[model samples]
Target: MISGFKLDWTLISPVYCKLRWYGLQFGVLTSFACTCLAAIDQYMCTNARLEWGQWSTADVAHRLIIIMTITCLLHGVPYLIYFNLVRAPIAGEISCTSDNLAFRQYHTYGYLIILADAPLIMTCIFGLLAHNNVHQLAHRTVPLVNVL
Candidate 1:
């Protein structure tokens, strides 16, 4: 029984090791992509106000404030939840890390919520693309059949 238990751990160890490797890869790539999106949003807002040079400093400031607020709520919070909550827990389990365990538990629920919203986001993106396609076609003439 002791020998079998030891063999089981040996087998399980590799599984956990692979999980940790994949988790870190997933987390890093996801974080980098999100950072790129944040940068893009910042760039877009700046270009709309400063590059155009029509808006006053107050107007630009207000726009930036709104953009930053929305991004923090929509992107930043969810990102932290995904990283410190979902990815970190799985990673910690694999590595047997006790540090940050409390933070991980606190954020676990956010991961559940984030997973639930994934489908909604996909639906919204597809709907937007379909709407845009219809709008583009509206300017073009299509052949129609007439029945007397």
Candidate 2:
């Protein structure tokens, strides 16, 4: 944004155009994946089952975060491939876009619809489960711990 908007630099470079698209998708997809993972983690941590609770450890969370980061970074590779500098039909004005027809469909329906909404739905469901578990904690009997 700063490079393009603030600096008013021309995006004639193919590498810059590709990297810009990749970076945008990477940031968005990674955050969505992490948010869903966090909700799932919270739900697991609040579960009464020992095994479920065991899955919510800091080590597990860190590992999952790293895995998701790599996954999201890789996911943006298609965007980098498909996105490029294109000339408009009207006035021959150059703009960054994908010329691939199938990719355009996927970006519209698959990415914009399914990939985007899936996380929102997952986050809502798991977040509500975690929230309910937290609220019900007071009524449940606490396990007595041996203090040091």
Highest lDDT model number: 2
Q: What CA RMSD would you report for each candidate?
A: 12.2, 3.9
lDDT of 2 at 28: 85
Deviation of model 1 at 83, angstroms: 12
Residue-level lDDT for 11 in candidate 1: 31
Candidate 1 residue 147 C-alpha distance from true site, Å: 19
What TM-score would you give candidate 1 relative to the actual structure? Answer: 0.30
Whole-model lDDT per candidate:
0.44, 0.82
> What is the alpha-carbon lDDT of model 2 when measured against the actual structure?
0.82
The TM-score of predicted model 2 comes to: 0.84
**TM-score on alpha carbons, each prediction:** 0.30, 0.84
Superposed model 1: Cα runs more than 4 Å off: 1-102, 135-139, 143-148
Q: Please, what are the lDDT tens digits per residue for candidate 2 over residues 15-80?
A: 888888888888888888888898899899898788899898899988998898888888888888
